[model samples]
Target: MPIRYALPNDADAMAEITCAAFAEFEDFDVTREQSAANWRRNLLAEAAERPRPHHTRIAELPDGTVIGLVKGGPADPGLGLDAEILALAIHPDHQRHGHGRALLRTVAADLCADGFGSLAIRVLAVNERARRFYTSLGGVLAGEVPPGEVFYAWPELAALL
Candidate 1:
């Protein structure tokens, strides 16, 4: 898989991957329309931000089929994290093939190069598979929010590289 910075043109494929990936989770509530709209809005916002507070990357095959995406940015100081992975999704058909890992690593490297020392990501508490994946990658349980969300953190972002 080749990972590259996401462009505005990649929004549609990113949204489709996001919708298909989330659709597999019964606890995730999102409509296709909402997902599409949200991706567009997010991409636009990212584009408009000066100095780009966040980075979005896409993972695709050599033939140009997009399969995964990851968006990350500086985290709120209150979260005790220097940066946070805002979103990560791989098309269901592409799961378990390392696309997700590659996407995450690519973004993590970008953040690390930008001087962020630690990273965190929040996932639905009901998502055991995701929790396991994060833990396997050296993310430790960091915190939780009410109504079913948990945070995973890598205190040393360089460890991921």
Candidate 2:
């Protein structure tokens, strides 16, 4: 897959990827409540923003489809991690390959080089698969912040990198 910055035209695909990636969590959960409708609204709002979040990226396939994507930002009511992995997904048909890892590494390096010393990301503690993948990528749970917490400490961008 070829990775690149996402363009405005990618919005629909981005929303779709976001939805599919988080399909399991689209319903209300113990830690948080989210719906597909709410997700679509948020995605559209972000897409329409004049000054948009800079961390979202896409992975394009040989066939020209956007098969994967990764996005990051700081957690709200911020703890100052400077960065957070908002969402990362490889289409169900494209998973089990290294696209996710490559996308993450690129995002991390970009954030780190951009003067962020640390980064934080919150994965639902219940998503054991994601939690494990993150841990393997050199991330540790600084602790649980609850209610969709980005797991890390202050200067989190520094600490995480």
- Candidate 1: stretches off by over 4 Å: 1-8
Q: Over the stretch 8-103, how does candidate 2's per-residue lDDT look in tens digits?
A: 245566656665666677442422123335445656776776555545667886556777787765455554556777677777776767778777
Instruction: Please write out the lDDT profile of model 1 over residues 32-133, one tens digit for every residue.
Output: 777778888988898899878788888777777888889999986767999999999988888888777877888999898888999999999988889999
Best by TM-score: 1
Q: What range of 10 consecutive residues in model 2 has the weakest lDDT sum? A: 27-36
Give TM per candidate.
Answer: 0.90, 0.70
